[model samples]
Target: MTLAHEMAFASPQITAYAVEATEYPDLARRYRVTGVPKTVVNEHIEILGGLPEDAFIEQALG
Candidate 1:
């Protein structure tokens, strides 16, 4: 996950979280996570489904 790299302990700039939607029902509901592989960036940008590495990185950063 590019977010991991960006938020790495070595040079942290952000916080990233990965939640199991089924395991954490409340979180899933709060985020309206109805599917797997959901990417939420900064609690604002959201990318559903999958994208190429370059595109994923781009979205994650933007």
Candidate 2:
């Protein structure tokens, strides 16, 4: 979540969601999210795993 916090600090326009571990089960099952730190952008781009800031930004914005 800290990464997300940092991102939010870096870009005011960046949005972040903090899905709880309990709620994650449902979303994970529904979206086939099978990993920690998975990031979904606009509900279309589902990034499967953790990534560095620049790489994550590129994927999210590119």
Candidate 3:
């Protein structure tokens, strides 16, 4: 989550959002979130679990 915020800060093209599954049940359900720390990029790239910064950026931007 910190990385996401950092990336967003570093680049204006990037936007990051942090949503609590428990707080937004409908949103979580729509995203098919099954675990914490899930990252959905462009509404398609579903990264589940914590990842190293490089790997996370690769998957997110690649």
TM-scores for every predicted model: 0.73, 0.71, 0.95
Candidate 3 residue 20 Cα shift, in angstroms, is 1.0
Over 1-62, each residue of candidate 2 has an lDDT whose tens digit, in order, gives: 67767777789898888777457688877766767777777888877677887887788776
The global Cα lDDT (0 to 1) of model 3 is 0.93
| Poorly placed runs, candidate 1 (over 4 Å) | 1-11
- Residues 29-59 of candidate 1: C-alpha lDDT, one tens digit per residue: 8878887788888788888887876787678
Q: What TM-score does model 3 achieve against the real structure?
A: 0.95
Give the winner by TM-score.
Answer: 3
Rank order by lDDT, top first? 3, 2, 1
Q: Summarize candidate 3's per-residue lDDT along 1-62 as a digit string, tens digits.
A: 99889999999999999888999999999999989999999999888899999999999997
Q: Cα-based RMSD of the predictions, in order?
A: 2.6, 1.9, 0.6
lDDT of 1: 0.74
Colliding residue pairs in candidate 2: none
**How does each model score on lDDT?**
0.74, 0.75, 0.93
The residue pairs in collision within model 1 are none
Better of 1 and 3 by TM-score: 3
Superior by lDDT: candidate 1 or candidate 3 = 3
